[model samples]
Every structure is written in structure tokens, then in C-alpha cells.
Target: MMNHMKGPKGYETEGPRLIFEKKLTKTNIRPDQSRLLMPFKSLIRNDFLRPGIGAILVDQRNVKVGLMLTRWDMKKNSGGGTLNYALTCGSNDIVKGNRLKKDDDISFWSFRCHNVICFALVLPP
Candidate 1:
């Protein structure tokens, strides 16, 4: 059986750290597995203004696994907005079932409403 250990107060023992530590390479990550992906320049630039563009979350294979919906809006902290950076993960049932239980590094790219491409390398807690 998998031995699970508890970390700090707000941390998971075995989470998405593999994705963060692993370099960004072209790997064959299944949608049903936990993975992360990077976005193309064009796709990144268009995400901000066009809500339809949606938020794309990738796996190690550079394949999009999930889309950020209301969560994106929640990040808008103007009025009742969480005002936090919008980061999301996408994947199938298996991947979702085994989400990041601990803090992990995530690379994100998105366009602002002003058509400015924004990039962020973050460790989600």
C-alpha cells in the first residue's frame, strides 16, 4: 500500500511536486493522469480579453487537461473577487481524483483584458 505521511499544517505529503520538479519536456501524459502543460504564445495572449478563450491547465505532456471557469472570475478581487491569481488544473477523472494534495510549482501564462500577456511561475499552497 502507498504510505502517506502528513506534512506541515497546510501541506500534502505526495502532491503535484513531480510536475514542478520535472523539466518542461514533451512527455506522453494521459488525460487520466496528473500532468501539466505550457501554453503557446498566441494562446496565452488571447486568454485575457476573450473569456471564451478560457483558462487552460496543462500536464507534463504539454497537453491541456482542464479549463478554468468560475474560478477565474473568483480571482478578480474588485468586487467580491478573491483578487488572487487565477490558476487552474484540468484533467480527467483519474487525474482529478488524484489532485495536488500539497503545494507544488506551476507555470502559468495568460492575457489581461488589456491584451497584455502575463506570465507567472508560482508554487500553489
Candidate 2:
């Protein structure tokens, strides 16, 4: 006997595309060293957190590296009450993922010397 299974439909296929186009703006900052809290909050308030929106992180060269789907949590450390924000990186961008986590020190890459990057957070349709 033959069997059939359901699969993704129109919205599912087009969701990522739409989200990528509307949500976030491109930046010239490296993923490994930039402090994205302010920028992220601004993006969420202005773009993603609206009724239906999605966002993805891109590299300095406008190359999509990782995707930020949900806002998890933010904590304050005892040391000077520093704010630590936690985010989910859904993509396999080494710079945004493993590499960023490998070191504790914040190291920023220069845009002129490095690459100009940005993120696209698209609103759902």
C-alpha cells in the first residue's frame, strides 16, 4: 500500500522570505563584538514585535549568517548590575554562534577594515 504525508504549504514557504525583507535593517557591524542590545530593542519595538514580524541577522557584508526568532530573557549581573541579554541564533553563522561564545572579551571588527553588515527582520504577511 502507498502512503502520503502532509507537507509545508504556501505561507510556510513564503514566511521566511517576507520576514527577511521587512523586519531588520542592514548594519556595518560584526556579529562577534558588537553590543546589540540597544539596536535589537529598537528593531523589535519598531519592526518585529509588531503584530506579525520576523527577523534575521546578517554579516558585515550583507550576507545572512544567523536568525533571531524569539526574545528569551535579560538578566542583571551582580557585578555593576551589567545587563546580559540572551537571544536565539537559529543559523550556523560561526561568528555569531560558536565564535562569539568562545571568548568572553568583546572584540569589535572595524567596518572599513572588515565588512559592512546588516540584518533583515521582515514583517509577516
Candidate 3:
């Protein structure tokens, strides 16, 4: 009896091609993390959320979605004064599958300094 899936998928034993993304927020000068949020939001908005940078996604929990490389969001600071920020990166780059609610635990990692990083929920929307 065979027990393997088909069509370009990596098993957990093969390790994770995905990792956590990092935060790209500056200090004392921003309304929100637009660039990072945009791609992250876009990933959530659409179902293109995957676990790798290239086209092929993996099948592992440790994998991540993607990161924002450009400032695609339309957010600007007119005065540059202390802007309104609302980003909460809970916990380190650790996703405990059962210890806590998936939404509450946010993970992030920097792949050779890509500005920002973050992780996605185990479940899809």
C-alpha cells in the first residue's frame, strides 16, 4: 500500500523550505508597516499564500508565506511626527501548534536581512 501524495510536495521529514519573516518597521517615524503589511495582507486577501519564495510550496508547518520587499502601500507621514503604529509581533519565531491559539502567535525571521519578516497561520482563510 502506497502512502505518498503527488505533484511536487515535500514531506516534513525532508525539512522545511519555508521560515518566518521579519519586521521592517522604522523607529519613531511611520504610521504603519505598509510594505510589510501590504504583501502580508495581499497574501491573506488572496489564496496565493504558500510556504516558499519560488513557485513550488512545501508541506511543512515550519514554512512561511512571504515578505514585502517594496513599499506598495499608500501611507505617508505629512509631518513625520510620532505616527500611529499598530503592529504586534507576539512571541519569537516559534509556532506551538497546541500551546496557544494560532492567531495569537506571530513568527518572524530574516533570510539574510530582507528588511522584514513574519509567519502565517497554520490554517488558511
Candidate 4:
């Protein structure tokens, strides 16, 4: 996790730690798929997430997008204890609203506002 990093869209340079950043892939923007996969290697910390709980994230425009933090356990099927995570639920709306295309760079930042966990999706200039 990166702390005290500059935020996108001229946000404060004091808070909003960066969790991960990646270029959009076809799977992320496909309407049929809808979910944005967070590869294991890219995840900084997931301790802030609660199981089965959905979260609302804001974009640079302050548009709210609901997303569910989900984990896929490989142990149940493949007998491997590895786990994978993804952001689901309203991810498609985020993609549509942001006009995200393949290879478009985006970043996820985490912060706490009024004791509530908040996230922001940032687009590269």
C-alpha cells in the first residue's frame, strides 16, 4: 500500500492511500463480465473489507458507484488455499461512466472519512 500519495483530479496530496493501479483489460470493460478482477499480487491490503458487504466508491466527479469486495477461494474446488479477489456489483456502471477502454490506466485509492471506509477510482491524465 502507498500512503500520502497524490490523488487524481487535483485532490489532496495528504491522504487517500493507493491500493492498486492497473490498465484496463477486455474482461474489465466487457458488459457481460462486469467485474473488475484484482490480481493477488496487486492487492495491497484487504483487511478493511468485510465479507459479503458491498461498498460505495466515488469517482473524480464524486459519482457514487457501488461495488462488492468478493473473494474466490481456490481451496474449495482445487484443494489449493490460494484466494482471489474482485470488485463486482456496480462495476459495469463505473466502466460505462468512466468510458474505460482496454489499456486505460486506473487506480484505486482507500481512505477513511468520518470513520467510514471510502474508496476512489482515479483515471490517469
Question: Which candidate number would show the highest TM-score if scored against the true structure?
Answer: 4
Work out the TM-score per prediction: 0.29, 0.28, 0.22, 0.74
Per-residue lDDT, model 2, residue 9, is 35
> What's model 4's lDDT at 86?
78
lDDT over C-alpha atoms for residue 104 of model 3: 36
Candidate 4 local lDDT, 1-125, one digit each (tens): 23223334445443467787898989889999878877766777666656566766787667877778787664656566666677888888888887889999998887764445557888876
Mind giving the per-residue lDDT tens digits that candidate 1 earns over 13-93? 332222123223323134543334332221323333333234434333334334543223333346554322222344343
lDDT of 3 by residue, 56-118 (tens): 111235443333233223355784332121222322221222233323323321122122223
Candidate 2 ranges with C-alpha deviation above 4 Å: 1-54, 75-87, 90-125
- Count steric clashes of candidate 2: 11
Which regions of candidate 4 fall more than 4 Å away from where they truly are?
1-15, 74-82
Candidate 1, 90: how far from true, in Å? 3.3
Q: Rate the local accuracy (lDDT) of all candidates.
A: 0.32, 0.30, 0.27, 0.73
Q: Cα lDDT for residue 76, model 3?
A: 54
**On a 0 to 1 TM-score scale, where does candidate 2 land against the true structure?**
0.28
lDDT of model 3 at residue 91? 22
Runs in model 1 with CA error above 4 Å? 1-52, 69-81, 84-99, 110-125
Per-candidate RMSD vs. true structure?
A: 15.9, 14.2, 12.8, 5.3
Which pairs clash in model 1? 35-59, 36-58, 36-59, 36-60, 37-58, 37-59, 48-111, 65-90, 66-90
Better candidate number, 3 or 4, judged by lDDT: 4
